[model samples]
Target: MKILLIDNASLTPVNSALCCEPKTGEFAKELQALGNEVTMYGQIVESENIHAFNIQENGINVVGHHRRKLKIFNYILLYLLIIPQIFKSDFIYIFYPSAFKYISILCFIFNKPYGLYVRGEMGLKNGVSSFIYKKAYKVFTVTDYFTTLINSLSKSNIAETIRPMINLNEKDIMPVNKKNISGIFKVLFLARLEEDKGVKEILYAIYKLKKMDYNLKLILVGDGGYKKEAMHIIDKLDISDFVELKGAIYDIDKVKNMYLDSNVYILPTYHEGFPRTLYEAMIFGTPIITTFVGGIPYLMRDKFNCVQIKVKSVESIVNALIYSINNHEKMLDYAKNAQTTVKPIINSTRLSHAEALHNAIHNI
Candidate 1:
């Protein structure tokens, strides 16, 4: 089987150095290991009409177009260049549904069937993405909410909810002996720094916790356009020392260690499909305090696996933080339950995505 992996999700500006999507590369590599020939459509910052070998070292062929400052003529030229590659493959698997809005039309013209994976929200700019979903062979979304939304919009029964398979290694997992979360508590927030992500609310929550005389350090990771705004909040609240904005740590090992080093993880996001960060934090046995939004409730229980906070509520965040701190033993229990809940689903290497892809392709 020849598989064409389309990773159209743009990386945050902070992740510019890394050329390949980690999950897509891992998924494609797994497919290739299963004896399928896989080719990736990479997202590179290029100036001219060009193609670069992105993951050739990993045994996957890549052909990509320049993403930054791309004009209408550039897209036209890129479409022409990529059309032949689409013709060469037996199946097309797209990472982002909106990306297929235009490419799916080309696939339709060439009589090629493609499967779309919805990571988060859709591009409903012209209401044509619904039409694209309708034409797709399969629609795989990370959350049940997305599956239902796509099925309703496309009027197609092909939508399936496949869990986001996190790629964790033996080295990435902290040993049981080293997994103690006692002493000066360190809270970690790993997500894109944006208004909707609830970064400002998190900062205020940290301030409240500090005022309560809790010895804790809040670390904010990842980057976006809202960095300055978030920084302003931290400075204005006079809790700069309590919060550390690490920006985006591109090093994979560093990210894994960041989770391991922290005692708690929080994502007060206004919206999310299924946060991969929570999954990682759970796998690392870090207690999570997140808002009840999207598919998060499907995985995290109110007091079973995590502390459920209300979306866009600073008071809720502060209360959850206090509760977690006060009930340290129960917090650890929730963290343990979280790790147990996620262990069965995470595939690390040969992800469940492989099985999902296989089923989607053969079931047709």
Candidate 2:
């Protein structure tokens, strides 16, 4: 089978180099390994019109197309180049709906089947998403929570929840040692520093904790559109010393260390589509404190594996944190169970996701 994969979020000429969407690239490698000839089309760096390279080990050919920045001529040329590729390919796998827009028309004209993979919450009910999802042979989702929503928005019941590809190996896993619940509790908040990601809510929770004179350190990682505002909140509250805002660390080892050094991981995000960070925290045996949004509820239990908090609720965040601090032993239990629960999914590597894609194509 010849598969044409469109993942604009990934770096072009895909290799072992790390990028924002490494797992998506790894999945492409896995598809090639599954005996499918895959040509991954992604955005090219500036000044490069188009380039193609091969990952010899995986037998995957990666093509980098010029990234158009709101230019009509560029879009016209891109469509001309991509339509022929669609005619030649046996199947199409598009990561985001935006990318789907580029190929859906060609696929329709050629009478070819394509799979739509929804990575995030499609916030608005737009015609493009509705039409492509409805026309696609199948819709793959990251979480079960979005299954119903996608069906309603797309007006199609072809949506199925599939596991996300996370880069986790045995080396990244920390040694399971005896639980130590005492000392200055290290609470980690790692995600985009955005309003919807609950950065302000995290700050408010920390402020409430500080008022009670709780001995805890909050480490905020990742940079985004709300960094300055988040910084303002921290300074206004005069809790800068208690909180450390380490803007986006790109090193994978550094990220793993952050998880290892922290006693708990808190993601008070307002929305998510089965975030990979939860899997990372769980694999490292860090207890999770997150909101009941997106596919999070499907991945975890309210009080069993990890404590669930209410979305956009600072009081809920504070209460969950207090519960974690007061009942350290119980938190450790959650951490241990979380690691155990996530093992099967994370350890399987590309087999699970690849098989689902393969079956979706063959059945359709």
Candidate 3:
């Protein structure tokens, strides 16, 4: 089977492999591993169009266009370049909702069978989106919460749940013994520094914690558009001394070490379709302090594997942190339960995606 995979997020061509967002590039390779000819199309966020032409990166044929200052022109050229591949593909798998709005119409016009892989919260935008979703051959969403959202939009319950992002193997990773680091508590926030991701709330919570003289430090990871807002909040709150923004760490081992070293992993996200961070935190046996949003509630229980807090509630976040800090032994129990429970549940991986695509193609 020939597959045309499209995603909205850009990937940088570093050396011979595409750098950043390992999920998208890795999924393409997995599809190719399934014996399907795959052509992936995405934008490059870099300033220079280094690999403008179609190039083979990491054994998969990837065509990544560097978007110049004129964004519309980049999309136009991308559309023109991938049109032939879209026409030839046996099946199309769409990732990241932004592309679904425009690409689905082309699939419909060509009478091509395509599937939409919805990973997070998104709106229908317009009726055309609803129409395209309703007519889709298959719809794959990250969680049941997102499935319900998509079903409501399409006015049909055709969407199915699949966890195609299990990146941790228990045998390979040695869970961090946070007990080794005593006295000072370390909280890790590994996500885009976007405000909607509860960045502001977390910062405020940290400010309040520092005011109470709780010996602590926050390691903020990842880079995003809300970086300025986050810095502003940190500046205003006067919590700069307690917080450190590590930007984007591409090294997987370094990220794992952070998770292992930290006492708690916190991601008070507003919207999600089952973030891989939760699993990574669990696998590393890091106590989790996250909000009850999106597919998160479905994955974890309050006081079970994580301390669930209300979104945008600084008090709740602070209280959750206090609870983790005061009740250290219980927190370790939660981490242990999380580590054991999460391992059995996250059975889906890149291979699961390949099997699904293969089945979807064969069934058609």
Each prediction's whole-model lDDT (CA): 0.75, 0.75, 0.77
Best by TM-score: 3
Error (Å) of candidate 3 at residue 257 is 1.6
Model 3 steric clash pairs: none
Q: What is the lDDT of residue 190 in candidate 2?
A: 88
lDDT by residue (tens digit), candidate 3, 49-117: 222222364677666667767777777777777778788888888874775357877888888888888
- Candidate 1's residue-wise lDDT over 1-364, tens digit each? 8888777654222223334546666787888877788887744553211122236667777776566465666667767777888989898887764443588788888989988877766463236778778888988888777788788888778888876756663335443213454677788999878899998888988898889888888999887768888888888999988988887775667887898888778999987779889878877778889997877887789899999999889999999988877787788788888877776566454337777787668643
Task: Tell me the alpha-carbon RMSD of every candidate.
Answer: 4.8, 5.1, 3.8
Best by lDDT: 3
TM-score list, all predictions: 0.79, 0.76, 0.84
Model 2, position 204, has a per-residue lDDT of 89
What's the CA error at residue 331 for candidate 3, in Å? 1.7
Candidates in descending TM-score order: 3, 1, 2
How many clashing pairs per prediction, in order?
0, 0, 0
Candidate 1 Cα RMSD (Å): 4.8
